[model samples]
Target: MVERCKDAGITILPSAGPVAEMFNGKKIASSTRARDLKEGQYPAAVYVPRADTVERFLAPQSTSATAPSRAPHAILI
Candidate 1:
């Protein structure tokens, strides 16, 4: 995955297996098709698709940031 991303610049690839995020022992997100994103020199980060996330556990915040390649992203509270 890393090698492929390095060759293509920033890229997203499927994870090897199920991935989940937990907070205070409660699952907030999970996915079998989670994506592994590699950008620049940063460490790879896993992103679970919105459809698979537990929306109830998230609260929108007023903060947001824009990137050159993507839309403005809101901060989750």
Candidate 2:
């Protein structure tokens, strides 16, 4: 999935907070959704990444290189 995103010129920046807390403390750090998932408080842990925060990074991309690809649409988890 990540490779496919890269191929489509969509760079992925994953959150390492979960992993870092898990490994450092030997416990899965709880997030609202993680805890909700555990307790069945919701069907799924849905998240929409804030692309606006990374606007500066995408701003410099060349038009041709960054044109949206049609093969695959965006996926969020």
Candidate 3:
């Protein structure tokens, strides 16, 4: 499915207004420059830049995963 979506070309565009991610009652990430990505029939994903994220709230994962069409990415905790 992922490979098929990659072949179809994912669409990425700037999101309207701001985008934010919250955990518990705390804000982990917030960005006005966040991007909305849509691939095939999947739900859109909002991607916030690392610079807009709160560093104190994010801990880098020891191991990272790499997607076939994307670079290796760390899972924050």
Winning model by lDDT: 3
lDDT of each: 0.75, 0.30, 0.76
Candidate 2 Cα outliers beyond 4 Å, as residue runs: 1-7, 18-77
Q: Which ten residues in a row have the lowest lDDT in candidate 3?
A: 1-10
Model 1: per-residue lDDT, tens digit, 2-72? 43544447778888899988988989888998988878898987878888878898877666656544435
TM per prediction: 0.76, 0.18, 0.76
Q: Write the per-residue lDDT of candidate 2 for residues 6-77, one digit (tens) a residue.
A: 544433333333321233344323332211111124243323233322232223322243355431344221
- lDDT comparing candidate 1 with the true structure: 0.75
Candidate 2, position 32, lDDT: 28
Query: Could you tell me the lDDT of residue 53 within candidate 3?
Result: 94
**Candidate 3 structure quality by residue, lDDT tens digits, 11-76:** 877888898899989998989988878877989878788999989988767665565655366757
Comparing 2 and 3 by lDDT, which wins?
3
Q: How close is candidate 2 to the true structure, as a TM-score?
A: 0.18
> How far does residue 29 in candidate 3 sit from its true spot (Å)?
1.1
